[model samples]
Target: MYLAIATDGVELQQPERTNELYASYWERLGPDEITKLLAEHDAGELLPDFNHVMVPVATLRRLAAGRVPEGWDDDFAAMLAHAREKGWLSEDGEAVRAHLERER
Candidate 1:
């Protein structure tokens, strides 16, 4: 959720906006690095500007099919937790699944 803060004459308020902002970061980093990056972001130390994030279909398929790379399960679990926390999973999971199935 994107919080729009408005200040008017000594009053700071958050305005309700119809649009929400969401972002994701995916890279080829090792598991430890990925965990560190997610930790930094979760601690509000990093802010990335992104909208709809996607992984390569092939990679996603492999992941969904239980063929993860070495040490990827933990990273994937963290990603899932993040997505669920942001409410993006409910909104996008079906579409992503469909896309992956189609790519098979």
Candidate 2:
């Protein structure tokens, strides 16, 4: 089950039986037997690659806290240009001005 501990000090747990299958499978195999089996299969590529670009959770929290880093203005300008090219932003001056004001 998925679990989450919120920053506001709330603890949450998923009430589900998804882990039952895994529990039964492990029980039937026994811990030591499964350990041996895993050791034998360790020579083969059994896991998928998890290579991915990601920002740190802490860094995201800091950014959300309005702690803008150096060069943020340049980055934001570039992002705005890209968004404009993608037609996500309105072309009118008043709309653009209002959007920028709300962002700050």
Candidate 3:
């Protein structure tokens, strides 16, 4: 599952097939503003597994075009809990960490 912040709104897309992930990756590119905003970060943060980025939940909410999909609420909460335990969250718990796969 992935959250896409597009020109219209945020879309939660789940590919049926594993190879579909590649198609979804570049189907519709996000606005340059997204990269511009990310580039503003001077000190990059990393999690154990990947080049992780710590983004404020508030920011994600603001960028969100819609509510979380049904049945995903608990999963989202669990994700946060796991991040917190892994020290992937911010000191104040205002931001959550996400993997930075690559520059598009």
Model 1's C-alpha root-mean-square deviation from the true structure amounts to 17.7
TM-score of each: 0.28, 0.28, 0.48
At residue 72, candidate 3 shows an lDDT of 50
Top TM-score model: 3
Worst 10 residues of 1 by lDDT: 95-104
The lDDT of each candidate is 0.31, 0.27, 0.45
RMSD per candidate (Å) reads: 17.7, 20.9, 7.4
Per-residue CA lDDT of candidate 3, range 1-104, in tens? 34343334433355121111111123344335344334443212233453445556555444432554554545655666777888767888887766554426
Task: Give a tens-digit lDDT track for model 2, residues 1-104.
Answer: 11121222211122131121011121334334433432342211111221111112222223223444466555544544654565533465111110100101
Which stretches of model 3 miss by more than 4 angstroms? 1-35, 39-50, 65-67
lDDT of 1 by residue, 23-68 (tens): 2233334334433543433211122322223322233333234333
* CA lDDT, candidate 3, residue 64: 33
